[model samples]
Target: MDEINSSKQVSVRDFTTNAVQVLDPGQDVMQWTFGGLSRDSGHFRDADLAKILRNVTAAPASAFKACRTPEVLRIIEILSIEQGQKWGVCTLNEFCKFICLKPYATFWDWNEDEEIAAAAKALYHDIDNLELHVGLQAEQAKTLWPGTGLCLGFTISRAILSDAVALTRGDHFLTVDYTHMQLLSILS
Candidate 1:
């Protein structure tokens, strides 16, 4: 575990400077595009991703390794693609249309999250009228990115780290995109 921990502390580029060829010829380069794109985007800094992986594994309750590997990188690439696709369709117009089909509260469930309800009430001061609360929530939802998929980041993070294994070579980072004020996860 100590050796594993030490590797994560090292600069990612130090290791990556020596590129390891993918052993499998049929390993579908297209699937690896997200990984390459993420690396090229400058958004997912390798060192940063290494740090995040370290942080996650450092948690006392964590059941994951801090090592990065090709398999891990592949998983991260897929996750990035999923996030990009979700964001591509996460337009305000789409949110408005979605709200019309279903009340925003159904997905958000203000009552379920006391903080959400309190914040809504604080802004509107109309807890008595359900319609007003719903409307206020809808407006708030519009201001959020991925208006429909609010908890996507948490979900994806859990999925990515659920397996109890050490990190390996191609492993990358998954991060929350807070700019949209929505719970979105993206490949870093």
Candidate 2:
């Protein structure tokens, strides 16, 4: 932290710490790295998972410039917080409601694990203010059923499932590119 702070570069960590209004000055709050899909969760108005992480992931290692893995992860978390602050994007419950799923009623509902829920509560103060990325990642992953593909957190699975359904239902391959067998072959 001191090294990054000493350099001329703007400290994104400091920005995030301030932007999110860290609930505890003594505790380090990287709110989005909750062991779920945080690495994949920066999707919002000005920031996206790929846009936010591609450069960091592609950065030169032991070369001209490099970022620590934790630093990169923190940047993703920071982007989510900044996006929420700028755009007033929906919180986790609101997002679930938008997507036709039940909103998590409490922090415990968000993550069954006692410790994780406690940590999230400490940082966010309430479920109503929980950032989309943070709450989405904090949710405990649902058990994968037989023959089902994803083992994602409950919210992530539902969000992804809805998106995938929309994409497949509106696919150009089944509409714009539709074709029939040649006339000669059909006759034969």
Candidate 3:
């Protein structure tokens, strides 16, 4: 921290101690790192850190081009409606569409007894095809974090948002979730 303060080459944000505490609960040691301080310290007074945060927070809509195909949009609409109703939202038609849709579409026969059963089969087929095309992206990821290996199966689907955020270099990777934040800090 003293070296960073002395060099003064990179603009640093000053996060309040309170904010830092809130953002990093278990891994408070991260506050000592340059990136962590910039995010947790109430020091947005620094021009450079402010600019970095702004760039990070902006949505990457262009990346969603692949997610908006007609088939994906339809599925997203269905999922969004179901999710919206559960959340007590009045009009989730549009928002649900956005959340459920993806750039890639996988087709499957829907003759199964249950809609979920049919959807799972379709999703499995799509994943198998995707695995062939991408050559085990999760396997590649295991090389990066070898200790526990890459999360797979059901957990992989739940991690889509985090995976997307991880791809963004400009994002502030801060959070109270120690495990995720720790991984982000290392990856960043």
Candidate 4:
């Protein structure tokens, strides 16, 4: 884990230098999650992270009526059948009803209407061909060039370590039993 952090510390510096070059060319890059280095640094403030999560949750729900993905629906149906077999009652409806129990059930709580609408528009613009790539490249940039305070720096640094497996596409996700060199197989 320590070694991965050290490597990421180095990679972030390199990535940031490259990002500056790309942005300098007037490219259309989404810098919203760049930890505010590109714009209002207050957006990346600690209080904002929680608000961001809340907004994300509400935006999807308001824009899509429901967050029912096919995979999630299937999981709910299977769980319903299993629970019905044991309790002789359809727990599926109860589970579905419980969706409102979430904190973002009301969109007003997050003030996310505009953000969600904007995100939906952006997503649909490129929806014809979905990109399989993860957003780790941007995440890497955030960890490297975060414009937040020392507290955020330490938080993002630790996050970089925790998500090292995801960021590097390592063979194993984060396992204390493994050495850093073995995990670098993904990089190779």
Judged by whole-model lDDT over C-alpha atoms, candidate 2 comes out at: 0.66
Q: Give the candidate number with the greatest TM-score.
A: 2
TM-score of each: 0.20, 0.55, 0.20, 0.18
Best-performing candidate as measured by lDDT: 2
Minimum summed lDDT over a 10-residue window in model 1 is located at 61-70
- Which digits, one per residue and each the tens of the lDDT, describe model 4 over residues 74-171? 33434444455576442222322333322222222212345543453364333211111111111112222456432222223444456774556565
Better of 2 and 3 by lDDT: 2
Residue 141's lDDT within candidate 4 is 22
Pick the winner on TM-score between candidates 1 and 4.
1
> lDDT of each structure?
0.40, 0.66, 0.38, 0.37
Off by over 4 Å in 1: 1-52, 60-96, 99-101, 105-108, 124-188
Model 4 collision count: 0
Worst 10 residues of 3 by lDDT: 132-141
Model 2 off-target regions past 4 Å?
A: 1-10, 13-71, 144-150, 176-188
Model 3, residue 104: C-alpha shift (Å): 22
- For candidate 1, write residues 1-188 as lDDT tens digits: 22434543444443344334443456765445433335454356677678777987785442211121334344343444456556654432233344443333332343435565566567546433333213322333212355553322222233335433325323433223333334333333
lDDT order of candidates, top first: 2, 1, 3, 4
